[model samples]
Target: MKLAFDRGRRTRAATWVSLGLTFAVALVVELTFADSSKADSPLDSKGDQGNSQVERGRYLARAGNCVSCHTSPGGPAFAGGLALNTPFGKLYSTNITPDPETGIGKWTEEQFARAVREGVRPDGAHLYPAFPYTAYTKLSDEDVSALFAYMKVVKPVSFTPPENEMGFPANQRWALGMWKMLFFDEGRFLADSSQSEEWNRGAYLVEGLGHCSACHSPRNFMGAEQASMAMTGGEYTDKVPSGEIRTWSAPNLTDVPNGLGSWPMEEVAAYLRTGRNGFTETHGPMNEVILNSTRHLSEGDVRAMAVYLKSLPGNVGNIGKAASAQVIEDGETLYNVNCGTCHQPTGLGALSEQAGAKLVGNPLVQASNPASLINVILYGPHLAKLPGPKRWKDMPEFGSKLSDDEVAAIASYVRSAWGNVGGAVTQEQVAKQR
Candidate 1:
């Protein structure tokens, strides 16, 4: 009986030993596969390959103009607190630094990608469309991974942005899911087989990361971009250095008289690179874009964007109407007194000191919306001092000097004179700009 009991105990011990061995082998196999998967992941492997991936990501970030929205004035880079004023309400940008508590430090690559492409948070909350995730959703996985890798290494800042000041339905984040269902098309860019490689690359950059249409295309009442008017021009409100909210027009990008049709591809590329071409200089929000984004891009990329912009079909849909002969004559007189010295009497513009942009064929002058022209007249050009010969002289602000009627008249004169196709500017429009 004693021998039988001992044998039973040994048999049970053997079974226990067998179970332990099986568990150990299974753990080893699981760990091996896990390590292999990590190594295989582009996010992990490319991130491990030093600064190359990070640098690429940085370039992509610039291309996306991330810093402009993420960083507020006088704030640390990428440490978000910028106030973005939408029609609904004011929304503050969130910190994107690597801070674990306030920023995206704890987010995984998958979470980051999902946030960017799907516009959903790690906690499954929907992001507002103001974040431009609708356009970002077209980002390729590789680019998304690169961006994540770059963000992971950014100097973590322990800062929390102010909460969004949205009212009613706009404040409700859940409604974004329905918004996405209606307007957001979540997918990657598919290169056109018929287009050239450069064209395809341009299309990808312009339509995807650039998100040009977000500003250049008018939005519906629901804040979704109007598909019918893709890039014919749109209006946005900008808060200038002085705590004043100003409305500016993003001009047409389509190949039309009011758009980039008159601009040579090289001129467009040059303008993007240096913020000034032979015709006009970058002002307002475009200053920020050039200073923070396009100036940092590679020549090839800038040229690609120009190519894409130049290729867009023209759609000049009732942008402006003709001014009266008396209004044009009065405007001409104002232009001669106020603007003609810099911009020649013929509107060819002088290249000498105090140079004015050629008003005759200028796209801004011919733009459908005269808000920008009016704003320029009101506030003067808030031009960025880019690296190049300072061809444009500082025009003193006429806001305190010129009446709304006078500003409107001057704008009307330029838009109608020299065969400029831009519509007339009203005193009411000028008053609103003020």
Candidate 2:
């Protein structure tokens, strides 16, 4: 009986050992195949990889506005050094050129895709949110591979930007893993079956690569955009041409009183392509968008974006009430004195390129919130430097010449004049912005 019990114990031990070996072998095989599968994706498969791929990638890069953030003012394209200001501190953009030591020349295709889509470096460090990989995560594997192919062939420059400056916990890159866990979702875009093909394409670009909400959507104290109030409006800092940093608010883009609710889709497309559409001229960051990105896009894409944007519902209760009679009369006089020569007495701006923007039926002039109008009047337009035909003439700044009350009057007049029902501008608002 003792001998039989000893044999039973040994047999059980042998069974357990066999099960452990099988599990270990299975894990090894799974890990090996997983890595190999990623490397051998259809997107990474060898094919006609030459001029066409590079050209397509170039278009995609332009659509993504890679150069705007990556290229510093007066710096070599893609060499990087652009300072991105955050509430905590400044973070410098990285060089994306093909330089072996400085740029991404040594990275494998899989590594490049991982960085673009997953915000993870080859060494497995989490990238800061400033990289916009949250939006890029929706990019398809094929598009990422194409971008990688294009980046690999770009003019390589041996340059490194300064290290990012953040205080304490904000500077720790490892902390981003937690941030991603909360906010980031890793996946490619899926076309909505319910939407039209054009709408779907536009939605993909806007929600993913364009990341328009980064600036347009309000953020909480944690720096995450408020998805609930998307495209409603947000305030950001912009450097004026005179080197002074000014607080500028991106106006609501939704179909509401203060937003793009009244704008025609065609006009929106025209504005994106040319920076002007007889309503308002693009300035500041938007100028850069037109110069570096949107202007280069196909007309179809621009139309698609316009269509998608126009479909958004605006805030119903956000509309401003009409101004008092005395305020309107006071504003008209100011408009006549300061703006009549350029914009004409009737508020129908001159047709000449050197003249002022048209006020009649102009969306910017009729916006419920007059922040953009005040900004343009105070700081003037900063024309984007681009290699193309001129879009719009520059406007002069009135900050030095006009008092806060006077600027408010002119803005109020424009908003209320010529069948426009936009509300009055306030001196207090003007003073705060100044």
Off by over 4 Å in 1: 1-49, 240-243
Candidate 2 overall Cα lDDT vs. reference?
A: 0.70
lDDT of each: 0.75, 0.70
lDDT of 2 at 217: 68
Model 1, span 302-333: residue lDDT tens: 99999988999888855657888889999999
Clashing residue pairs, candidate 2? none
**Predicted candidate 2 versus true structure: per-residue lDDT over 79-148, tens digit per residue:** 8787766544667778988789999989999999999989999899987666778788999988888788
Error of 1 at 385 (Å): 1.7
lDDT of 1: 0.75
